[model samples]
Target: MFDFVPTRSDGDALREYAELFRASFPDAGHLNETYLKWLYSENPSGKVVGFDAYAEGRLAAHYVTVPADVFIQGVRQRGLLSLNTATHPDFQGKGLFTELARRTYERGAELGFNFVYGVANANSTPGFIRKLGFQLVRPLDAKISLGHVAKVDWPAVCRTAAFRRQWTEAHLAWRARNPQNAIRFASNRDGVLTAFASTDKPGVVVAGEFSPDGPVTALPCASVPILPRLFIGLLPEASRRRGLAIDVPKALRPSPLNLIYLSLDQKQKTLPADQIALSFLDFDAY
Candidate 1:
């Protein structure tokens, strides 16, 4: 009852993708033409591979896979992330989600992507794990490590799994640089930026994502949130800080989210969940 059209990697197709995103996820603040161009069109690694399903010439469902070169245990692997998936309200519960996903993955395989990964919400996690053979990696957790600040070498850490997002200098430059906020950045001796923290809250420095090798300086004031436990393990034991309760409204919490992946080749199967490191930066922020 619908026609699936593979979208080309061009400006026009990217606009169409953004339009569908706005139509489907109306409440999402980040669904804009600029962000879509930044994500799918201007990505340094490659363009996004996706399809738009139309019912009688009306766009019904949208799906896309953003490819990233994942490094694990000193080896780089071709990986695709299932992203920007949505179905119009008019076409919900018609099996479009599964069909579009299947077709997208099949095309991704032909394009040399050996695996696909997604940080799926509870509602969609089961479909990927039970039906699509995606393994449950782990829940994204917050941790506080007691540690002295160490110099972070950005280039050196790029070969590690902890550097999940392929954020080039251009991408970082385009982000809002509102100096009015309490957000502060830490840089190494070479002047390369390593970590950032939001000092907005009265007594806590809300640490944002950073390079895995970066030092997480514990403030005398106490507490940081949204940091992954895996990165906390990298700190030297002597300087580690105690984990503090990171309280937030239930609606703002993504506790129900889980990381899932499906390996399409033997080489990809070797990359286990324990080695994969991720932060809020790795996933699409909406």
Candidate 2:
């Protein structure tokens, strides 16, 4: 039999949990104590939770939940951001993740969250689909519009301090980590960095970029309302053809931001089953 328990953010047990996470998701690269601390400490809404699985007195699996503020039809709604779920290699096929996820959902209900969200990759999508009954709701799409780039005011953009800081950090990180891809940022007159977008792949533009490290702030009114649209227009032509996939929110119809939708229950006949994958973000962990 296995033991499942909630973990707090202190002590050797938490340290062991962190180690297991690092080993399980190495592709995250540069995920250390500092990054995790930043995520928990700087979260604006203060909603984060964690669960750990134990077998034979050793930590074996883990999962976390984060609170996300999403906008639908101009109304802000709260969502449960499910992230960083992993099982130790030795413990695979034992249904540890499934059991823990069930518990997580129960906790989410108690906490008053309406829906759960995650970004799953190829390896774990099947389990989330077959076992957990999560459906594929959104597939990401990208489009490059060079005509929009020509209208941007580079001088005004550089003048804003907040925009400068966000641009500098985001651009440098993208260059170092994704040298081949392009990144862009936009600011309102009040100096708030209101808009950010990136192209991480050669011909793909991923918009809806934000500073992953801090809380989102309100931006000043744009002198030209179409600045955000212009930023999206700068994406490479080939990238426009190769769009990405994303999960859609339950209440909202498909738009640029919320493109996909998934249901945890299989009896609901809303979205197609085959194209979706289970997702968990690394940063959302407690």
Q: Please, what are the lDDT tens digits per residue for candidate 1 over residues 136-234?
A: 876555443322233333354555452254444433432222222322344444534433444323443434334432333431222334442122113
Candidate 2 residue-wise lDDT, 178-281, digit = tens: 22222334544433343333323344333332223333343222222332221221211211223333323334322342222232322233433222211111
Query: lDDT, candidate 2, residue 236?
Result: 19
TM-score, one value per model: 0.71, 0.57
Q: What pairs collide in candidate 1?
A: 145-241, 146-239, 146-240, 146-241, 147-239, 147-240
- Cα lDDT of model 2 overall? 0.45
TM-score of model number 2:
0.57
Q: Which candidate is the best by TM-score?
A: 1
lDDT of each: 0.59, 0.45
Clashes of 1: 6
